[model samples]
Target chain A: MAILEVKNLSIEFGGLKAVEDFNLSLEKGELIAIIGPNGAGKTTIFNMLTGIYPPSNGTIHLDGENLLGRKPFQFAQAGIARTFQNIRLFSNASVIDNVKMANTADSNENFFESILRTPGMVEKERQLDEHALELLSLFGLEGQADTIAKNLPYGAQRRLEIVRALMLNPKVLLLDEPVAGMITTELDEMAQLVKELREKHGQTIILIEHHMNFVMPIVDRIIVLNFGKTISEGTPAEIQKDPRVIEAYLGGGFHGNA
Target chain B: MKNKLNSILPPVVLVLIYFLIQLLLSKKILNPYHIQILMFACVNIMLTVSLNIVNGFTGQFCIGHAGFMSLGAYGSAIITTMLFGGMKMDPNLRIPVFLLSLLVGGILAAIVGFLIGLPTLKIKGDYLAIVTLAFGEIVRSTLRLIEPIGAARGMIGIPKITNLAWMFFFVMITLYITRNFVYSRYGRASIAIRDNEIAADAMGINTTRYKVIAFVFAAFIAGVAGGLYAHLMTFIQPDSFSFVKSNELLVYLYAGGSGSITGSVLGALVLTIIPEALRFLGNLTNWRIVIYAVILVLIMLYKPSGLFGGKEISFLRINRDSFRKPFNKFNDPKLADKQNS
Candidate 1:
């Protein structure tokens, strides 16, 4: 079943429409990729999907529930999460602190419990620490758990973004250009991680990727956008052969060779 | 046993130290003027810590804290004069009524904070700050216009129920509650919003809810401090809680280091006492204010983020490590038995 369905999504800025008549129906556990040129409004669509920008016209339904008129946190509560294109993190906080903040979404303990240091609250706090450490370990970030987030190397920062996003345990994860700037090794590791998320955790993913090689092999399906409109949609093999995609976006597609 | 001893020792030591100060006061070793200054330091600590919750941790610039304080002052003062009518009440009855007045003042300020915060907090940073400053001014002018509450001439002959003990108790409560709030999920969520609102919201944190909570809680504590201030001076005045009072609290928070409880303690305690220390210059009481301003400027130059530099001392960190094992032992019969045995 389609876990998320957007019909005729549209948004405008000033006089120009940033994204128009966009349509998407993502199945549960499916890995879908949105590909386009620099100004093709890919990020804009992600922004709308994640409730950062309210669409001028369209309906976004997650799990058959209307996502319109809901706050970003409410969208998150409905099991949708996203990472940023520019990597927004609590830069002053430690790496573990970043993950811990997001992990709090599921914690139900109150401040009184914290004040009195109740046993259950303490155990829950320990669990939170363990869970955050486990995630950091998965990303090879356990050693840097105490390091301030902005001090980490660029690659680590990118990885930490995913770690923070995953902390929400979202059913549908929207990763915006997850591997925008990465070496070959980091790109491969991220690709493997993305696949693992779907295969192991059954996480439904919608990704925006500029790297052709990264987007081509991993995604079950490809969505090509040009000039704020859906130019083509099909399997990667089909998308690779589509003439409109070649002329509009591919032009043999941009690849970083990772 | 060492851990148990360590846990029990700090509070015991704190009580002993507290009593020593009281003993000195009772013996007249410490003059009443000195005691008054010290008590005022404790009250400033409460106000500073409360403001830090909103401005420092949540990253909102709230300059209307004095407005909440004023509300609390007036709320409790009205109760004191209306209910008890005079300062010559029985000691036992006076203590409870004073405590009750603190509660009334805190609740009244909290309600006003909710009303103001709900509409203003939804906007951007600068706008929220402007609105808060405006709120403070509005409260001040409104109080001035009202005839019954003594207007600008001030409410006189109020009960002077506040003392060192009362100040100490409220200060500790403020510190304890703030420390707990900072380590809690709601507190982390507030910090997250401070770091990045969009990202925090994407992670399923209700940013508006946390922001408002922090604002209201800060206001409540500030109100309680205000009640203490009114009773401490035995007077209530609208002009007492001007923009200057709000700015003074902010200065104390920044000087101690925002986001650090120990810093707030150090900042408020020291800053409150500095002007009095300068009085030794003799007939230059106003020069103390001038020197205080210069020191603040120097502080801004050399230690901009404040003395602690945003690093918390964590003596009262709710030590999750301490909380974990023994606390859980209560739930597990086997663990409890093992400990007992």
Candidate 2:
């Protein structure tokens, strides 16, 4: 059974329809890749799915529950988490703090407890710090955890965004161009990381990548989009051979007419 | 081992120094004028740190801090005066009634914070600033029109109740609570929301909830400071908590650096002393404002982040021998594959 389902989802901004009748689904632990040209409304789908922007119409169901009208934070609480297409780390905060924030809601520490420095607050802070360090270690960033997030190398910053999202312990993780500006070596590293997240963490991931070469090995299923609508959905091999995808790619990159 | 000692040392020294000075003041070691100056410095510390929570940590531009302060001062004063001001039937109820009234005032101010925070949450990018400013103006104007409180004439004969002990106690509590909050997860969320709201929300943080919480808490502290001011001065007026007072609080926060608790305390202490220290300028009294304005502008231009920027900068360095051990044994590129893939 699908862990996430999107049916007839459409979003319009005034006179222009950014996404039209979009549909897709993911079974538990599936690693699906979304490939599109710029303006294919790929990020818009991620945005709508995350509730940053409400869809004009259609239903989003997660774990058999309707997800329409929920705020982004509410969507997160309901087990959906995502990283931005752009790096949005708290530039002044320490690297560990950037991720620790994601785990705040699960924490027992509150205003009163923290002010008094109760034994409970101390233990909670220690637990959170340990988990944050472990997450940083998973990304090979333990050394950089004490460093300000903005000072890290570009690739490390991207990895930090993922670790921060993992702080939410989400059921489904959305990566919006996770390896967008990295070099070939960095992309390779990220591709492997995305694979492990699914294999070891049992996280269902929907990755939007313009870098087709990066997605080829990691994706189990591939969905092709053009001009705000899904043009095709299939196994990675089938998507690679689809003639319509070729025409769509030729007519316009991912930004072409649906 | 040294880290724990380092944190504890400053507060112990500060407390000892404060009482030493207080004892000296009682014995007329320092002039009464200087004692008065010291008391005001403590009050300024309360105001600056409280405002930091809203403007600095939460990243909200709140220019109406003085309004909340005034509301607290007037609320507490009015309650105390009506219940125990000798004009009332019971002169015996003075001290306890005044203390209780101050708490009441703080709660009212917090309610005001919540009310203002809710409507302005959706408004940002200068609109929020204007809303806060307008709220301040509205409060002052309303206070002026209230004849029962003597309107433009101001309220007087409110017996002095806040003294050295109460002022320092509140100051310590405010600083302690604020410092703790800043180091907690909620505090981090507040800063994260400030840094990037969309990103914070996506991480499952309730951005609106945190923002409102910071604003209301700041308001409560500001209110307490206000209550203290009313009792300390033994007088109150609409004009006392005006836009100028708000700007003064801003100056303290900005000069201290919005990044850390230490900045607020240091900023408050230094700025409080500046005006009096410059009193030697004699006829150039008006130039004191000019000097302050210049210093603040220079700081902003050279270091847009502020004096401390945000966190405590530890000048202490790690021993070279301590680096012999690797920082992390578990960090491996292989781990990324285990987690990300």
Candidate 3:
């Protein structure tokens, strides 16, 4: 059975169809990439998937449960976690705090328990600190845990955002343009990190990216979008040769490298 | 044992300070006038710190805090004066009654805060500020039309039941709760909302719920402060909680450093005392306003983030070592080499 199934998902912004009849059946542990040009409704699709934007028409099912009409936080609680296209760290907060903030839904302490500093609350807080530190260490960010998030280098900020999203322990992780502004070295590292995240953690993932080189190596399957419609869907080899995808996106100058 | 000491230390220090003030008052070293100023400072501390939760930590713009304070003032005044005014009760009983009145007023304000926050918080930035500003004006105007609480003429003859001890007690309570809230998971959520609401929402935090919670909590504290203010002055008036009063609380919050609890306390205390202290200039007292303005301008120009600049004093911090330990580990050569590898 598919872990996440979207049927005929469509959204219109003021009579302009942003995403039309988008459909997918993602199995557990599968990694897919959505490749598109600028303004191809890639981020808008992500927004709909995470409940940030309610689709004009469609149904989303996570583990057979319908998720239409739910709020973004509810979507997060329902195991759909995502990182923004533009990095959105809690800039003023410390690095550790940015990660811990994502675990708020997991905290069981009530207002009275927290304010009164009950024994259980103290224990929970200590555990939270330890857990946050462990996740930070995985990304080599533990050393900078005390630094304000915005003060970190750009690559570190991008990595920190992924770490923050991972704290949610989502069933399906959606990353929107995770390496938009990365240098070559940072891009390779991010590619390696994303590959590791899937292999080691068994995290089922869907990502939107414009970096063909970055997307070609890491993703198992590719879905090409153009003008708010799916232009192609296949493995990397098949997608690389698709004449329609070549003409619309890769262009005549393109040569298959993979 | 060490943990126990750390837990008990703050309250013990507060108690000692309270007793010292009491001693000074009894010896006449601190006159009634001085005591009045101290009480006002305590009340302002409560107002400023509570306001900090919404405007500072939660990152919401709320300029109508005085509206909640007025609700609390009126609510408590109605309880102590209108409901229980005629009885010649025992002095000991009076304390409990006053405490109950304050609690009632606080709860009343909290309910109103919750009501107003639900719809208003959906809007962002400048629009929210304008709505809150208008809310304050609406509250003030409505208070004038009500005949039961003396209407526009104001309610008078309320008993002066608030003493230095009571003021000190509430101040400690306000500070303790604010400190604890800021450090807790819920408090972290509020800060997250302040930092980036969209990110916080995507992180599974119920943004609207937390925003309303902060608003209601701040309103409750402001209401309690209002009750204290009403009892201290032995009168209740709508004008006391005008937009100017709300702006004064904002000045206290910002001028002291908005996000820091210690900054709020210091801002309220220092700003409140400076105006009074300048009275010693006598005929030159007119120049005192000029001096105060200059000090404010200097602080803004030199340290726009306020005195503490989002940093807390060590005594008020819950996890002082957490920040220092990471920097030490970062500087260690072994860790740097491991990361490089």
Q: What share of the true interface contacts does each candidate keep?
A: 0.61, 0.67, 0.69
DockQ of each: 0.42, 0.51, 0.55
**Per-structure clash totals for the candidates:** 1, 13, 0
**Per-residue lDDT of B1-341 in model 3, one digit per residue for the tens?**
44456668877887898889889989989888998999999999999999999999999999999999999999998888964678777777777889899999999999999889999887666666787788888889999999988888899988899988889889988988888888888889999999999999999999888888888999999999999999999987888889999998998889999999998999999999999999999999999988988988898899899987699876567762432334534666665454335
Angstrom error of the Cα, residue A191, model 2: value is 1.2
Q: Using lDDT as the measure, name the better of candidate 1 and candidate 3.
A: 3
Per-residue C-alpha lDDT of model 1 across residues B156-211, encoded as one tens digit per residue: 87789898777777776787678778887877888888888889999998887788
- Consecutive 10-residue window with the lowest summed lDDT within model 1 chain A: A249-258
Give every candidate's TM-score on chain A.
Answer: 0.95, 0.95, 0.97
The runs of at least 3 residues in candidate 2 whose Cα sits more than 4 Å from the true structure, single-residue gaps closed, are A250-258, B3-7, B23-29, B87-98, B313-341
Compose the digit string of candidate 2's lDDT tens values, residues A141-254.
876766788899999999999999888888899999899889889988998898888999888999998777788778999888898888998987787678898777635343
The sequence of per-residue lDDT tens digits that candidate 3 reaches over residues A1-258 is 999999999999999999999999999999999987788788999999989999999899999999999999999999999999889999999998899999999998999888777878877887787778778878889888778899999999989999999999999999998888888889899999999899998999999988888899889999989989998999988998899999888878565321
Off by over 4 Å in 1: A114-116, A252-258, B1-10, B23-29, B86-90, B283-286, B318-341
lDDT to native, each model = 0.85, 0.82, 0.88
List where candidate 3 sits over 4 angstroms from the true fold.
A255-258, B1-6, B23-29, B82-84, B320-341
Clashing residue pairs in candidate 1 are A250-A253
